[model samples]
Target: MVWAWLRIAVAVVGFSGVVAGFIVNVDRARREGQDLGLVLANYFSLFTIVSTIILIVTFVIAGLWSLRNPGRSPEPRGIALAIAGITGPILLLGIVYNALLRGLPSEIALTDPSGIHSLDVWATESLHVIIPLYLLVDLFFASRRRALSWWSLAVIVAYPLLWLTYTLIRGGLTPDPSGAHDWWYPYPFLDPHGGGGWPSVLIYVAVMLVVLVAIGAGIVAVGRLRSRRAAARTSPVGAAG
Candidate 1:
């Protein structure tokens, strides 16, 4: 019951944060006199937004399941797999933003020099730092998680690959709303025309894919460890020992 409530709380906070960020972005776009449709498109195209949506959906379902099936052990394999799938990209989102992108110029520039800055900070921290940490905690300590097969790493990497492909293609096709550039990219690292060019972009993508797989492997390993401990607690041999 407690765990279920925690999941629900996490979901609520995540939803609120994402909405706040979106609203702030919209306001900033309006203030800057940019195209609202382009702003909306770029906003949802963000990996952070998409990953948070996945996290929110996964937790909402997991929390509700726990509430309805109190005391259940080893949640359905599908749920466990969903959790595994999200763990990698979400953690990567937090890491990449904090390490590389924090304080960088964003598509939605600050609306008034004075106002909405604090709100933006709060929304950014909530989405990038706080929720990701909570999800990490849940991954390590939450109840009802089942061990996933090693092959689940492929499932984990699949979404990111698709997102990368979509982002690159879209970046090439989408016009810059500010008219400052011919094409717009969500992150500088992914921008092929930046100082690094296609080679640098590919290098970054390759490194990121490798790191993502490592994280996914770690999640799967932790799940296996937790599953073993759980089984031990219930096994007669473990009880006897």
Candidate 2:
């Protein structure tokens, strides 16, 4: 009973956080004369939006299934696992890149001339920091391990690749407000005009790919271990019978 209520709480908090962040960011962007499309175009916002929606769906389904069949374990389909697998790694990347590499308080918070408000900072952290951690905890405690597969790693990798392609293509075509030849890339690491240049971008991509693969494998392995333990715990009763 407590576990069930906890899941409900998590879903509510996750939903609130995502919605709050979206409202704050969009309002600020609009104030600065950016359209809704441009505000939503950011990878950070896109990933968080998608991830939170997925999380909400997953939680609701689990809740409904539990209510319909008490004491019976919930078995989520592979699609949910695949979505979780992809979101997990990407959110991790966002958190790490923003917090450590970007020097969170100094770079991500203070350096932005666009004026990062308190609400904006909280929203950013909620998406990148809170959401990722929430997913990790849910995966460990609530998610059914049997639904996950090793091959989902490949499917998960496709997301980041797609994002990279879209970002590069858009950045190349769209001009900055100044009408200069320079285009606006979301992350500085991906921007060629920056001091790091193409080599840096390549290195960042390579590192991110490696990290994604490692994280995907880890999630799969953890799920498998949990499944095995679950099977083992039940095996004794079958043997007795």
On TM-score, the leading prediction is 1
Candidate 1 Cα errors over 4 Å, as ranges: 105-111
Please tell me which predicted candidate would have the highest lDDT against the true structure: 1
- Give the per-residue lDDT of model 1 (tens digit) for 1-241: 8888898898888888878878887887787788999988998899988888888899889889999998857789898888888888989888899999998875344335646766677778888999889978988998888899999999899999999999999999998878889899988999988888999999999989989999999999998998899889889999999
Question: What C-alpha lDDT do the candidate models reach, one value each?
Answer: 0.86, 0.63
Task: Spell out the clash pairs found in candidate 1.
Answer: none
lDDT of 2 by residue, 1-241 (tens): 4445555666676677666666666765566565566556653435456656666676666655555656646455654565455555546566555755555353324434555466666656665676567667766776443546778777667766776787777877665532345577766677888888888889988987888887777777777788777777779775566
Position 133, candidate 1: lDDT: 96
* Candidate 2 residue-wise lDDT at 48: 54
| Clashes (N, CA, C under 3 Å) per candidate | 0, 0
Q: What RMSD does model 1 have? A: 1.5
User: Which residue pairs clash in candidate 2?
Assistant: none
- Candidate 2 to native Cα RMSD, angstroms: 3.9
lDDT of 2 at 198: 88
